[model samples]
Target chain A: MTTAVRVAWLAAALSLTLLLCALSISIGSRSIAVLDVWGFLLRPEETAEAAVVTQLRVPRTLIAVVVGAALAVAGSLMQSLTRNPLADPGILGINAGASLAVVIAVAVTGIASIMFYMWFAFLGAAAAAVGVYLLGSGRRRTATPARLALAGVAITAALTALVQTIILTNQEAFNEFRFWTAGSLEGRGLEITGAAAPFVAAGLLLALLLAPALNALALGEQTGAALGVRVRRTRALTFLAVTLLCGAGTAAVGPIAFVGLGVPFLARAAVGPDQRWSVPLCLLLGPAMLLAADVAGRVVIAPQEVQAGIITALVGAPLFITIVRRRRIEAL
Target chain B: MTAAEMPTHQARLAARRLSVGYDSRKVLDGIAVEIPNNTFSVIVGPNACGKSTLVKALARVLRIQSGEVLLDGSPLSQYTPKEVARRLGMLPQAPHVPDGILVEDLVARGRYPHQGLFRQWSQEDADAVDTALRRARVEQLRDRLLTELSGGQRQRVWIAMALAQMTPLLLLDEPTTFLDISHQVEVLNLCRRLQREGTTVVAVLHDLNLAFRYADHVIVMRSGGIVAQGPPREVISAELIEKVFDLSCRIIEDPETGTPLVIPQNPDTAAKGS
Candidate 1:
């Protein structure tokens, strides 16, 4: 593809993402028009429409965009680091780690504040990633994709079991945990978004800076090393970046499923495997996917709403199966 | 040449009492050798004889367990990775190629060491990539995806990438693996041309005859020790082949190049012919 064409596609993707953001703010439970949302934005007062827009929809929309982009970029980095197309925070036990940490924090201390959950989630995500890395690299040879995936499966299973044990034992904790586990963008406010924004922003910055090295890494470890890339350092930094991304996003909105797994495939398909291009595209495509799912969830049951996590699973599972069934899935 | 004058063609890469192993199982033990500047040096050995291990050590992919590897009279560890890469380039056996990457983009990546955080994609990088593609005869395939190329074409593209690094010294581990006879010869010829153009080349080769034909200096090994090192005529003999490979063979001269060629003597055929 020509440079002109690629730039044009990127522009189109950006425009679509902006459109989704607008839709997310406008078409919630109240069904406000775009023009009305614009008018409300211009004049902030005690009007119910303005309150709904500023207090409710705007924070949710901002969180959606931030978390969506974070998960997608993290997914791309994970896939490249492990050279496994199936590697994602949700699939690789990272979300389970954060979820388990949150459950434990609430069950043990009975603190239901978002700040506590965010800190615990960050620590748990980092620990889980390190656990997975150690387990994968424990093999006699360098870690293969299958080995890393197996490690992820094992960690996910163990963490989920622990989470279930905690939630099943305490009824009150279960009530709070169930809502968070379902992964909805509703009822969240600016406080949650503000708490997670710095982490997501740092992760996004680190990922973009690491793009060139990630491209070399796609050529395999020894090859990347030969090309003057510091393989071990890059891998370490990638883990830190992924931790910040998955932890903060999960903490703010609670483990929304499939955005991390599905967005990278779409990004790679749209713009080839070069991380320089694919990573940025993932930033846009991820939010678009999440917001679209969130909007669909709101409208699917007019009086009530399906969670965004459920909707993403509904859409993402089939896409995942299709990718696997293809004759050749790109390895990195 | 006089003995004093010979020092002018000094070895740029030399290992002294080098030891390498993985997880306490030593693969190479106390080995010493020198790769002279501007020569096509080939290291040949039987399977599992530490040929790949030695090359890996030389390329800094494997850390030395003991002793030191010196590049241009300085210890390899003294230089930063980018500094070392600016002087030495390596092409590993069966390096991964990311899917859907254009050939030109792959070659341009060899400029990584030359590029800094702020210094990116300059005119010099473009010229180096262009020169590498033309030299490797893959310019026409520059815009094509790497997955679409044939095996030989892919190998040449990889070579083009290495060439774009523009290092004075190059190391290859079995560059001709998995290719047909004609393609193997083509790659070897390219290595020969690179040597002629003053890049010091070192490679690990399986084919003894091809090594003899192309190598200006040859190192034969058995069980992690150098068995012989010199020009092919001085180093390759029937006795050395039998000792190193455990295969009885008769050494003959190539009709076209007069390089040493090995004709293995099968026990059954040898008895019947006699």
Candidate 2:
């Protein structure tokens, strides 16, 4: 597609996402009119409706947007780095690593707060990424897609086993672990968003800087190197970016499944495989998908909300399958 | 300008006692050679004779274990990757093409070395891409997806991408691999055209006859070292073929081009005839 057309599409997508964000903020357990929501947003007051909008819905919406974009962009980078369409934080053991760490924090410190567990999650995610890289690359060999995928599977299985053992041994920790594992975007305040923002921002900035190199990398490592890309350096930075994005997102919202796996395919379908276009598209589309799903979670049960993670899985699984079946998955 | 006006264009590529290897085994050991400017040079040898390794070393894709590759009288390692890429481009054997990538976009990626952090997609990039597409004869297929093109057309598009690099030197490893005879000729003809336009072209070729017909200089290798290096007509002979390939062969002149052609003799057939 032409650049002008792509820019037009991006603009349309951004507008639609903004509309969805408004809908998410206005329509919750208590439905407020769009005008009232805007009035409250524009003018501060001590009214109950204003409090709901400012203290509750606004923080939730912001967290959803940030976490959603982080996961989606991280997923896209993972797929491009591994050259595997199926790659994501969940698939690559990143989320499992975070889950294990969060479980351990709860069991050891007896602190069930999401805020406190966030740090451990980031540490676990970074460690898992490094482990995967070392195992996949091995001695004297760069990580190929097949090798990376296999390494991810091994790490994920091991981490899941450890997490299960911790939860099973401690009944008190299991309750918190169960809720966190379901991946809800609830009860999180602006503090969580503030804490995760810098990491996510840094990751997004690095991703934008590396997009062109990632595009060349999709051609192959040797081809990327020949194109003047520092292949080893790009790979290292990509791992760091994915770590920051996924670590922060997983910490803010519990291991939200499928957003990272499914969103990139949608972005790639819209903008082709050029990372420069696809990564930005994912940034916008991811928040849109997450906010829309969060809205659905709030309304589907009316008065009682399902977690946003469940809604995304319900929507994302069939879409992912359709994509895989509709076209032959290209070999990396 | 004409070739006589320029006289000898300084050698842009040279290797000094370079050694390269993978894992623990050495592939090319202490071999040195220089590629003359504006010449279509072909490296040929039997399977696993390190012809590709030497090409890879020259392109800086393979790290030299000893000595250095010199570009314009400076060591290759001293220059940044983008600096080297600005002057040299390499087309690896069987490069992967991303699914659903348009031809023009793939060709445009070759401008990566010239693009900067803040400056990208300039008019010069556009012009280079256009010239490359026209020169490689893929302008008509620029909008098509790479997967949709035929083998010959795809190879030409890849050449167009390398051409878009706008480098003085180009190295291709088995550029004609997996193509039919006609497509092989088509790619070779494209390389010839590129050489004519003053691009130094070096390729690792399996077909000795094709190398002889197309290459201005031929480097023959055996067991990680140069067996002979000269103009194809002077260097290619029955003795060289037998020594390099471990096969008895008769060297005959081609009727069309008068380049040496090796026709291997089967020992059983020779004994029966005698």
Candidate 3:
């Protein structure tokens, strides 16, 4: 794609995202009209729906935006860092890291506050990332994608085994683990968004800052180094940004499995290879996609909503397959 | 113009007692050579003779074992990577261009060394990139994806990227490695044209005839050290080609260009006296 076309596509995606975010707030279970939702937002005294708008739907929509953007940007960064189109938060084991941490917190300590679990989730993700980095680096400064991937898989397997073992030993924890691991936005409070917001914001900031260096890195280490990018520093910084974004998103939305992978992949297809524009497009397009999925999930059963994670997986899987069939993988 | 009045064309790039290798296998040992500024220099030797290694060491991609590479008599290692990159640009044998990368964006990356943290796109960068694209004859291809171009066109794009660096010295390792004869001449002509624009270019060439025709200064290497280096008239002799390349060649002049032409004797008939 030409640079001008990419810029235009990104702008269009951004505007569409703004519309979707508003639609998400108004299209909840009670089905408030768009005008009434806007009126409630503008003037609290207008309707009885104001409280539900403020208390439930708005916070839910905000969580969707933040989490979706975080996951998508994180996925884009990971794919570039690993130079693997298949790399994503779920596939590369970051979501598994958060899941293990949340499982231990809920199963072992019976920590009920979602706010507190955010901390453990971030820590667990960081530990998993460091494990992967160290194991992959293993005497080499830069690890190959294949090696990093293997290490992530190995760590994920071990942590997943531990989670299953914990669940087997204590069936009491199974009830809590079942809902969270299945991935939903149900029963999540506003405080959860507040808890995970700072980390995701910080991660987004790091991502934008690292985008230029990451663009240089796409040309491979020798070319990137010759172009004066500090290749090792760039790689390390990209890893940190991916970890923080994916970790915090997982904390917010309970390991929304393929959103991180799928959104960025779609954004790249839309915007082409330059990360400077692609990252921002990923941020906007991610939530637009997730909210659309969320709405689809809400309407799929008429009343009984499928989990947003399940909906994303359902939609994302076919879209991914279509991408694999239609576009050459090398184009990524 | 007097040397003093000239636009600082002399870039004294040299390596002092440079030794470089991987682990215990020393590829180059105690190698020393001074590169003259504002001239087309070619490093030529047989395979594994450390010509490419020397270029890498000079480019600072490979770490020196004992000595230091110096730019303007200051140790090259002492300069920051960006600082070194500001004055010296390098093109490895084959640079990978990601699919769908636009020619303009790839060229814009050359401004990385000069760009500040907060600066995204500046006028200086745009001008440099524009000039580079024009110089490399890739202005039309600037909007085209690299994957869509032919090999010769893509090579020009890579050269445009290095040219966008606006560095005084450019180092290329085997820039013509995978080109046909016509494309090879096209690339060599591009390098010579770059030298005409006041950029000092050093390239590694496997083709001795092309090297002799294009290079103002030629350095022949044998077993990791300089066998001969000077103007091609002095360096591209039959004896040097045989000793350096282990090939029996007769040195003749290109009638039209007055450059040294190497005519290699057929292998079957070579060394009939022996």
Candidate 4:
């Protein structure tokens, strides 16, 4: 019966996602009809409007969904793995790593392709994850949530400071970063999507597999072990998955903030903390949230789209603060 | 039913000359114990006496430093982690509950060992989870967030999770810690009920009185080694308490159950009496 309920919820969530996606396709700045969006997606060869919709809005909307899901799922994974409700990709320095690496790449080699940025970001994220894991674990038999969060804050602050310094030293690099850091969804082509899709997919898969183990982990290492979970391997895999998801998403979108942090928290409020449900709900709610914000950005000011990232922050910061204030945000 | 009729050689759990510790310090050394089938045994000791450590080692949470734990007489290390989990379940002291986790879902996690990579959810798993929730008496709180439950209620939820594992042997580490007197009795009685239903139960208890009242067998530990082991009346004495706990205590029978109860005499009172 519980499985049935969860399946029903998943089905409902998926349907809602599709509905939101359709609404997103229809409600952009140009206000294309739902029928037109469907026609454009299904049979693009028939009309010019179809071609325009297929070429521009489809990829953009899909990118919003992918980025949203990836970031939120990564955030949720990191939060649970570290047992900290406050944990997110950006707060943990994964995004900082990606952004800094990209800045360095752009500064040194004048490389600006999303592909190059993706690899650079992944490398940086890997380094940061390893660093945090080692520092957080300390001499303890297992890493505690409080230790991991502290380690994340320290490493993230240091990396952010370093990245800021690079931006400060180079005017050209700052000019590029200044625009990208605003977190726009403008002009991100199919190539950016292609570059990020595989990593995001892999992250999604890894997170799904790690969900049950993470559920046990939420009960602490000893209890998790008593339940037969390989806690160390589970934790390592979770960290790796979060790195890939956040790294790839940030590389694609140049650091969309708070979507990762906010969406999963909301998903938890909706579905509860069993990661089997929480993770999948995160995948759905994430993209719905991102696409909703993107659409809001498009229509909130005609012909002048607000960056989806900025919009998410506008919505997310207050909500996150509310959670912190109303509920205890301690590690599970 | 005769002993032979019971799960024969199902010597489901045994520790063989086991030594367990952290870093260079030993916590349990060269101790051999067999958890007899269908018995409720309790490990009782003061704080830091290695009762919990011994249970963790027995459950494979802590690595054995020098010896082996066995299941059905086979080396425990030979069985896969999941295999051991399939037959043995443990409830560690004060598990860190996930925020806003529903009690039902938390209990459902016990089914992880029985689940396969391909089999997501099954009727069998559902039945086991439901049965556990009922047995632990948390069925009414199934939809409630674990955070919303009281301490005893939450503790029961954790036990319910262990029950969901459907294992024959259940180990609990300080399962009654932090509970009020009433709640402590409630939890101990719940363990007794489980044991009566044929689950082999082992618990590390801090309250000697409670252990004496609840356990069929009691193992006392001090400084990483057994101080005494037997039925409570046969083992607990003023001398043993002084030796293990460094306290002068008077041993008396409880007014209700007639179990041995330790009354630590004040040092002043002892001096005055002397």
Docking quality tier of model 4: medium
True contacts kept of each: 0.62, 0.62, 0.59, 0.72
The local lDDT score (0 to 100) that residue B54 gets in candidate 4 is 89
Tell me which of candidates 1 and 4 scores higher on lDDT: 1
Write the residue-wise lDDT of candidate 1 on A267-301 in tens digits. 87777777878889889988999899998998889
Interface RMSD of each: 1.3, 1.1, 1.8, 1.8
Task: Sort every candidate by lDDT, greatest first.
Answer: 2, 1, 4, 3
Model 3 misplacement above 4 A: A1-7, A33-36, A43-50, A134-140, A146-158, B1-10, B255-258, B270-272
The digit string of per-residue lDDT tens for model 1 on B158-212 reads 9889889899999998999899999899889989998998999999999899999
Instruction: Please provide, for model 4 over B61-120, each residue's C-alpha lDDT reduced to its tens digit, 9 standing for 90 to 100.
Output: 888889888888888788877888998998888788787777888899999888767987
Model 1, C-alpha of A200: deviation from truth (Å): 0.9
Tens digits of per-residue lDDT, candidate 2, B1-274, equal 2212332326789887888998679899888787878999999999998988888788787788998888988898998888888999998887888877999999998989898899978999999999999999999999899999999999999888988999999999899989999999999999999999999999999888899999999988999988787789987889999899999889999888999988989899989988
Summing lDDT over every window of 10 consecutive residues in candidate 4 chain A, give the lowest-scoring window: A1-10
Docking class of 3: medium
TM-score of each: 0.97, 0.97, 0.92, 0.93
Clash tally, candidates in order: 0, 0, 0, 1
* Candidate 1 fraction of reference contacts recovered: 0.62
lDDT of each: 0.87, 0.89, 0.82, 0.84
Model 3: DockQ vs. true structure: 0.53
Better of 1 and 3 by DockQ: 1
Q: What lDDT would candidate 3 get against the real structure?
A: 0.82
Which pairs clash in model 3? Answer: none
Q: What's the CA RMSD of model 3 in angstroms?
A: 3.5
- DockQ (C-alpha based) per candidate is 0.70, 0.68, 0.53, 0.59
